[model samples]
Every structure is written in structure tokens, then in C-alpha cells.
Target: MSGENETVTYRVEDHVAVITLNRPEQRNALNFDAYDRLERAFRQAVRDPDARCVIVTGADPAFCSGDDVREIMAGPKPAIPPPPTVRHAPTPAAMAALECDKPVIAAVNGAAVGWGMELALYADIRIASEKAKFAELFIKRGLTCDVGGFYRLPAIVGPAKAAELLFTGDVIDADEALRIGLVREVAPHAELMDRARALAARIACNPPLALRYMKEGLRRAAYGDPRELGGWAIETIRTLMKTEDHREGVASFLEKRAPVFTGR
Candidate 1:
């Protein structure tokens, strides 16, 4: 079965559901609409009883370049109402991926930076293409990442390396990511999906119930409660968004210049 919308696509084959972020022209950079579609795609995967595993990949040339900075971050600030009293609501897309019962793999085909890297971290495992690159780019934008960075990155790549990536916003090539244990394997760019699907097929051959429980067990044993971390991340990002540094960061990126940060 296969289906597609403007920004996301879903297909199921051999008990594996594949979700593609579908904006190659834009390097799969997400807007609000893409985020909603991504959430829905993961939910659909979870609801499909035949789907024992899931693979998320982006179109050619990029995995996901992060948010569409032009659309999401370039505009003048709008006045907003206060958030509701609910203190621990994760973003819909992140929550959906995190809560998915099926084993999830990120097939990182190319650039996976900023929230793109966070998306990869949300997966149970990541398989990268030789062309893939990863980064925690939020600091360069004077923002913090969603919960995936804080909750999963440290566990995957060690606290010190995670701190360096998060603090410097430096990009890492696929081999570097592999060396740091950020990806399980790196395939030739042409074979990326084939490699991911082969791995997913092996995983899907397991008993569904066992796989689900095993995934959940690992998450519970290895990580802190994401809800609490998510709440804190959201609040910190909101505060940072209002700062002069954030504004300058956005402006400089749009202008293709170096960002001048002021500790305002």
C-alpha cells in the first residue's frame, strides 16, 4: 500500500512501513504542514498491523535539512497566546515517532542537521548513506533542539560527544557519525534504502509482540522520561526565540553571513 501528500509519503512492503519526507527541491526542509503530515504518517504506520517495522528516509540529495528557515523563522514575530497549563506535551511529530511500537530505522541519505538530526535520533536505529551528514545545529540558530537530542543523543553517542555536537553545532560526516556510534552502518549512497530495508526485514521476521516489548524495554531502561525533558526543552526554546541573538542568527543565515551573537 502506498499514499502520498504534498510533503510526506507512506508505503508498506514486506511488513515494513516506509515514510519519506517528500520535498527534494527544498532538501526536505519542513514547514508546519510537513510536520503534521509526518506525524500522521507515523500514526498510520503504528495502526497498520502488518507493519512490524518502520523506515524513515528523505528524498534524494538530502535526508532532511531541518525546518524551512525561510518559512518558519524569517518572518516578524507574531504575538501569541500563552501555552495551556499542560506541562509535558511533546511536539506531535516527535511524540508520534517516539511512541511508535514498531521498530523504527532512520535511513539517512544525506544531510540530517538540526531538527533533522533530532528526527534520526528518534529512530530506534539509524543507517546512513556515504553521503549523509549529521549535526545538532540548534545552537547556531540560538535555539535548542527538541527532546530527541537531549534524551537520545547522549545515550547513543556519549555525554561528552553529545555536548560537543550540541554546543558547537558542528557538522559530522557519515564516517565520523559511524565512528561515534551515531549510525549502525553506512552504505553506498545508491544502496542506502536497500540496506535499510534488508535490516528492517530481518527485524520484522521476529515476533511482533516481542519486538514491541523489547523496544519499549530498551527505551525505559536507557533513557530518562521524555515528557519532562520535552517540557523543559520547549520552554527554553521559547525563551531563546525572543532573544536578540536568535533574531540575529536567523537574519545572518538568511543573508549568508556570519552571525554576530550578543548576550542580550
Candidate 2:
């Protein structure tokens, strides 16, 4: 899928699919072309059976600089704004990773600002390098967080922390990211990709069906009232009880052996 999409390069390694943002010359900015191309790349991952998870990161010093401002301002600003919503969705390619039953992890290799941060937000998990820096950046530019950042950040870091970040548009490092629960872990700059792949591999080894339900359960909990979450949790557990992996897991515990799961 490398040459198939000009703005994004899709690759699979050990069942961990990755969509690398490749426009370093432009700081991997979310140009319209990038958006359109990424939509395709993500859908490709959705159709890949061998892939149970994915990682998205940039090729160089910046994960993304957000939408290409030069491109957007290249034309007149729309008299009417898009309103408060996820800017990159409705395109199946961009929404694919978010809606995918499989997990998606973001490896924030470097600076992530503006919509770039939102791209990471859409992932199920986040891992970043110490060198990684993040900021909402919308307010700084006389705009609001029109992308998914406003919605996703609070869910990851809680409402207060998310408000602080958005209100100040302050840049934060990896340590702060970990403190706020925005990222699962942080690694040295040189080890960022290795760590991200390792985490993805771990999630990939879990039973795919159970993992899918687990992800759904979490998303459901995040988006709704407590009663809905209670019902979903019960149903998910019931479904998992019927899987071969669950039987193996219990037996392995009883037999004092490591469970060998084939994502059944």
C-alpha cells in the first residue's frame, strides 16, 4: 500500500499494521490529499484479517502539524464553519481506524499539534517519546478545537486536564502525557517505535473477538450513562465465556501452564 497512496504508506509487520504519515517536507500536515489518502489506507487495514492492530506515526521530526494551513488559507476561509465536530470523519478512510473492531495505537514520535493531536486521540491507545510534544494549538491560531481533540482529550485525561490543555494551548511533554493518562507509556526517542510495536504485539496476541468486545465495552462506557455500561459489560462477559480462548485461559491457570492463544 506504499505507492498505492501518495500521502500515506501502509505496511504490516508481525500482524501490527502501520499507516505512516509520509509528508515530512510538509511536516506530515493533514492536507486534503492526506485526508483522502488516509481514508483509503485505514479501510485497507479494516479489510486485513492478518492484522489485529495498527499504529500511526510520522516519518520524521513531527507526527503532524495539523491540517495544511497554507493549503486551507490558499482558498478563502469558509464563511460558515464546520461547527463543533470531528473534522476528519464521515470519510470512511479517516473513520475506519476509529470504528474498526480491532485496536489502533498511536505512536507519537515527535511534535503533535492541532489536528495532529486529534489523530492520535482517535487511537485506542497512545505511546509517545520523551521528545514528543503536544498542544491543541487551535486557540493560538484564532480557531477552536474543531477536530476530535476536544472530545477525545477529556476522555483520555479527564475533563479538567483536557480543559487546561485546550484553554492554554500549552505544549506538554511525554511525562505530562503519562501523568494525565493520555498515553499508556513513554519511551526514549530512539526506542519509540520499538515500544509501540511491542505494545501492539501484546494486544495482537489477545483473542481477537474478546479484544474487539473489550474495546467496544470501553467505548460504550466512555460515551454513555452507567446503565448502558452495566448491560454492555454483562453481555461482553457472557460472550467471552463461550470462546475457546477463555476455556484455554482458565485451563492454563488450573494446569499452571502458559496459555497459547490463537486469538480464537
Candidate 3:
């Protein structure tokens, strides 16, 4: 079904809920509003009994370029308040994809950077287009990995490889991602979605209840308590938000120039 907001759209076909990130003009870069809508879409897929599998992909030319840096920088800042005794809870949006027990696939047709990369990681399987690229770009933004990247990336790509990508914030082509096990398969750009749907259909043919239980078992085996890691990531990002490096990162990004970091 088409979403109320155009930033994200959802539809079900042959037992697969196909969710598309729709902001191609900005390379599907998300702001807070888009993120909220995406979370809702994921939740809807989970609740739909007929959706045995879910496929997430973006509009042509980009999957998602992470958060909209311009929007983040230009948005009004909230007033600082005293810290509460309890730690801040993670946002539901961050965990929405993972909360689904049914199989989920990422049809990475183009650039998937930062949060986009994390979103793809949340999927049980990833099918990439030859034109696709992947990156963990939070370091360049002077931010820690968010949206479960720290918990998921190492599990998918191994700890050492994950560190290199996370530290350098380097972009890798689809072939590189495939070689490193970040994606299960890569197809030509024109045929990426068809490949993803075929895979989703194959999985959907299995007993749905058994598939759900198997998915939960696999997840439990693969991930630790995400709550602790997610909490730490959030707090680290909060601290980074106040840093001079982060401010410079945003300013340099907006100005289209190299950022001069002082290690502040």
C-alpha cells in the first residue's frame, strides 16, 4: 500500500511486503519524518499475517544516504535539560526491522551509506545490484554507529573487516561486499528487484510458523543483548553531538569541503 507520506512506500506482492524508500531526489536521504514512516512500514509488515517475507529497497540511484545532513544541521535544537537518573531508551525506529520475526531481505540497488548500511544489515539476507555501494559513514560525521550497526555489522562481516569499514568510513562496491559476505548475491542493476523477489518467494513457500521460529533462533544465536550496545551507542552519539569535531563535520559537509578535525 502507498504510504500517507511519500518519503516511504509499502506494498505486498506474492506474500512479500515490498517497502521502498522514495526520496530519490535527495538520494533517499532520511530526516526524522522519513525514519518514523519507515519504522511504521516495518511494523505494518510484521503485523500482516499474509506477508511471509519482506523486501526493503530504495528508489533508483540510491538506497539511502543516511540521515539528511542538511536537515539535521538546519533543524532547531532542543533545549538541554538535566539528565534523568535512568539512561535514555533507544528509539523504536532503530529496532523496528529487527523486531520482525518473518524473513526480511534488502534489495540494495544503489548507495547504502551510514544508517542505510545499518538498515541493510538488519535484513536476514541482502541482494545487491552491480551498481550498489555500501559504507559505514558515521565516523566521517563524528558520530558513533547507530541503529544497531555496532551489533549487526561484526556479526555479518566479522569483527576485523567491520572495524576497518567503521573506522575509515570507506565505501565499497557490491563485489567487495559480496566477497566479504555482506551480501548474499549481486545482480545487474536492472534485475536486482526481480532476484530479490524470487528469493523472497522461495522463502515464503516454506511453512510460515516454522520460518518464524527458525529466524528467531538464528537471531538469538547471532546477537547478544542489543539493548546494552544500543544504549551505549546512543549515549556516545549524544556526547559526540556536543563535540567541536561533529560541528566541523556538519559545517564542512554543508560547505562541500574537507573537514579539519582537531581531535576535540
In TM-score terms, candidate 1 sits at 0.95
Q: Estimate each model's TM-score.
A: 0.95, 0.76, 0.94
Q: For all the candidates, what are their Cα RMSDs to the real structure?
A: 2.0, 18.1, 2.6
Backbone atom clashes (below 3 Å) for every candidate: 0, 1, 2
* Ordering by lDDT: 1, 3, 2
Model 2 regions more than 4 Å off? 76-94, 224-264
Q: Report every candidate's CA lDDT.
A: 0.89, 0.73, 0.85
lDDT (tens digit, per residue) of candidate 1 on 1-264: 244446999888999999999999999998877887999999999899989999999988999999889887875533112346656756778888998988999999999998899999999999999999999999998998889889999999999999999999999999999999999999999999999999999999999999999998998999856988887887788788899999899899999999999887
Best by TM-score: 1
Q: Which stretches of candidate 1 lie over 4 Å from their true place?
A: 1-5, 76-86
Top model number, lDDT: 1
Ranked by TM-score, the better of candidates 1 and 3 is 1
Error of 2 at 100 (Å): 2.1
lDDT tens per residue, model 2, 1-264: 687447888899888899988888888887767776777778888788888888999988889877776564233542123325433233233356567668888899988987788788878888998888888976554445643554467877888988999888899988988988988888888999999898899999988778879988987787433233333433443455456675565456446786676556
Q: Higher-lDDT candidate among 1 and 3? A: 1
Question: Native-vs-model 2 lDDT?
Answer: 0.73
Order of quality (TM-score)? 1, 3, 2
